[model samples]
Target chain A: AQSVTQLDSQVPVFEEAPVELRCNYSSSVSVYLFWYVQYPNQGLQLLLKYLSGSTLVESINGFEAEFNKSQTSFHLRKPSVHISDTAEYFCAVSDARGGGSNYKLTFGKGTLLTVNP
Target chain B: DAGVTQSPTHLIKTRGQQVTLRCSPKSGHDTVSWYQQALGQGPQFIFQYYEEEERQRGNFPDRFSGHQFPNYSSELNVNALLLGDSALYLCASSLGGSGNTIYFGEGSWLTVV
Candidate 1:
């Protein structure tokens, strides 16, 4: 089975400060990794995904995540965050070999990112 | 195009009661999946519907059932609800084949008293 672990339950950072949300996964086979952001009472939005090609993937909002195969990590980073960046971040994994709901995602508990002013 | 949409944004039900949540997939999407998210926890897969049939199901009990319409809409029904069932029910839609992106709805909040 595949599983995702987010080391931080919560991260507090001031606006304009850099932040990193740590994520690690355990899976027997190759996997697709993703980061999602959820604001209060809203659905999750895809931040970025690591499918193929480059080991580093970036979102449009200046956030990026590097897929580290040896470390089994996909940590999300932002050079500088703003108040609008405050949300819950989730790390998820899906089997690279597709079949039925096996394509379904296994997500970590989530890290609440609070960008303070 | 409009994204995945779920109905009954919030509702409360008593134990032993039944509840149903509805979802309309995004335009051009043919597959629908349901998930249950407890407070402060990650969402858990419930099932997936494709071609108006159930393609996959998670470890949920028989009390959890679902249906898919020809129009690609779906419904999630839970019978004999328990307090543990209180959580946010999310509906996600995607294309049937490989490498498709799945989009989620805002979710329906179900509270079992």
Candidate 2:
């Protein structure tokens, strides 16, 4: 079984400021980590994922996350956030042993990021 | 390409009643999964369907069920619903195999009274 914990329930930052959403996971086996963003009245959109490769993965929208194995953390960060970046961010994990896509994902409670101008 | 799509954007039902939600997987995808998102919480996996059969399921009870069609579309049926069942139901689709990305729909909002 896998579980995710988001350290913060809400984060408020001014536009152009940096922000980070903390996430930690507990799993008996290796896992795939993902960050998903849900805008108002919209579905969850994949922001970035850490399947395998470098410990750091970046999204097209300037968001990035680093997978820290020792700390069991995958924290999402952005240097300069825009008002459009305000959304609910969720951290999810799936068992690496599942061996394929469409595997079950365990998600955190979620962190609401509000970017103020 | 059309992304995962779900039907009945929002619906209201009473306790002990049953409700059915539908989903159309993304184009060229053969796998569909269902999730439930409660207020102020993240989505929880309900089940996954492949090839018209259920392949994986989560910790949910048997009252929650689903079916996959030949066209890769799916339907989620919840029986004897309780107020706790009021939540957003999401449908996701992905190709059946390794290295595929799963996509989600906007979700259907179900309110149980």
Candidate maximizing lDDT: 2
DockQ of 1: 0.57
Please state the interface RMSD for every predicted structure, separated by commas: 2.3, 1.3
Best by DockQ: 2
TM-score of predicted chain A against the true chain A, for each candidate: 0.96, 0.97
Score candidate 1 by TM-score against the native.
Answer: 0.97
List TM-score per model, in order.
Answer: 0.97, 0.98
DockQ of each: 0.57, 0.76
Which regions of candidate 1 deviate over 4 angstroms? Answer: A99-102
lDDT of 1 by residue, A41-116 (tens): 9998989988888999999999999999999999999999999999999999988886423368888999999999
Query: What is the lDDT for A54 in model 2?
Result: 98
lDDT of 1 by residue, B11-80 (tens): 9999999999999999999999999999999888899998999987888999999999999999999999
Q: Give the C-alpha miss distance for residue B108 in model 2, angstroms.
A: 0.3
- Give fnat for candidate 1: 0.42
